[model samples]
Target: MQLLSPTATTYSELQNAYEHFNKVLFDNALPACLITLQREKRTCGYFSAQRWANVEGQFTDEIALNPAYFAVTPIVETMQTLVHEMVHLWQHHFGKPGRGRYHNDEWANKMESIGLMPSSTGQPGGKRTGDHMGDYAVEGGRFLMACQALLTAQFKLSWYDRFPAEEHVAHGQASYASQLSDPAAAISPAQANQALANVVKPTVKAARQSEDGTSLQAPNRSNRIKYTCPSCAQQVWGKPGLRLLCGGENCDSIPFV
Candidate 1:
């Protein structure tokens, strides 16, 4: 916050956000990743695996956030995008990943475990796994708690796009509306509204992240679509509208119908 130039401040803020979430959400097990601010048309952010290497063959993954959406995107939504990509990074390292832009259930479940609900439609009942997905903070979720913790520790994102894109919908995140409906954790929508009174800066109204995720824009693709591999006859279910591949070993198969 002192004599640092604009470039330093902007990247530092994002890097700090990554570090904060890594500890609280991922237990700090994820290695450091190169963070960049590159804008992709209609894309909020993305995680590209092993995009960089040193002369010694040291490799590093890349996570790029779109600066174009910075000014217009809410702080929490920006956090969601970052974590969404981080989940991808995690899968690339540890779990079995679906090839070529396919989001597997493992990724979706991990997102849920960390407090971000994955949805192709960006809303409740949306497909949990797919290409080009949207996500929201979970109700009474660890992600929300982590956000509260990060803001409380006085983190700031100091830079943004000058010509921000037109925001289509206000992506919603939950405060404490847990799906379990435990009386101890449940809160009314009005209460959820008041939950972020001191969390988001520049002062914006907070919306409740509906149970399961947000429904602001993804196709409410059917929830019961099933696809089976033609070669191995390995049957798998997919959310309607999600493109998936047959993961059967050595089976050259087309995507799920």
Candidate 2:
């Protein structure tokens, strides 16, 4: 399907891209799932199990891409996010068990088999974690190659404009939380748009106080620990006493303080 324009925002384009990638990359092995665009902070895309229920009272998997994040990202990088979540979905359905947020070796191996080597730092090589490691995709990997091929074939891909600009909020500012009482009943497109219209945007505020009434402050940069990738000179900073990897798909350099 050819897109009407480079900046189109039609859902059909997204669906077509999903179907195309499923056929070309996964050999049509992945099951069908609901794909939606959401306005998420920080997260580029997410894959959740059984988040939506259909008219038949059966739960279905969901893959939500953050339009706010993707609007400014390169098309190739956007495809990377999609493929990354697909990898997660694949792992969740068929691969070995993974604990929490850690992507196990089996997951990494599967990702590599598809031409997306995981790097923690978005670089080239990454640290080894009991044989597998968390990683981002490498440049010129299979995933990118596939995306280029699809584009070359004139596949339609749509990306919308960025969300309206809001007041800048520092990282780790106010915390906004929500709970799902129950799966929402399936609704039509009109109903969905009405529901979205009624949603209130969250506001950012200063950090909250602790139990003892002490005001929270941002972490001290001096006291925090830092990790450096020997190969690419990439630096990651975080709380003290934690080991980190260079996170580069090709570099895979062990981090040092």
**Model 1 per-residue lDDT at 233:** 46
Residues 1-257 of candidate 1 have per-residue lDDT tens digits of 56899998888899999999999999998899999877554566788889899899999999987765454344666777888888888899989877677788998899999988887766577788775578767867998888778867877666554433222112211221222334322321211232221122222212222222122342233435344343454656654333456666775544432
Model 2: weakest 10-residue lDDT segment is 174-183
Residue 52 C-alpha lDDT in model 1: 90
State how far residue 1 of model 1 sits from its true place (Å). 9.0
Q: What lDDT does candidate 2 reach at residue 200?
A: 17
Please give the lDDT score for candidate 1: 0.61
Q: Model 2 scores what on Cα lDDT?
A: 0.50
Error of 1 at 54 (Å): 2.3
lDDT of 2 by residue, 1-257 (tens): 97465434567677777887788789888888888765554455677767799799987777777554232223454566677678777877788646655666786787787777665533444453322233344445666567767767766444343231121111111111001121111111111232321231213322222111001124343454433443554656665434455567765544432
Q: Give the CA lDDT, 0 to 100, for residue 116 in model 2.
A: 70
CA displacement after TM-score superposition, residue 51 of candidate 2 (Å): 1.4
The per-residue C-alpha lDDT of model 2 at residue 193 equals 36
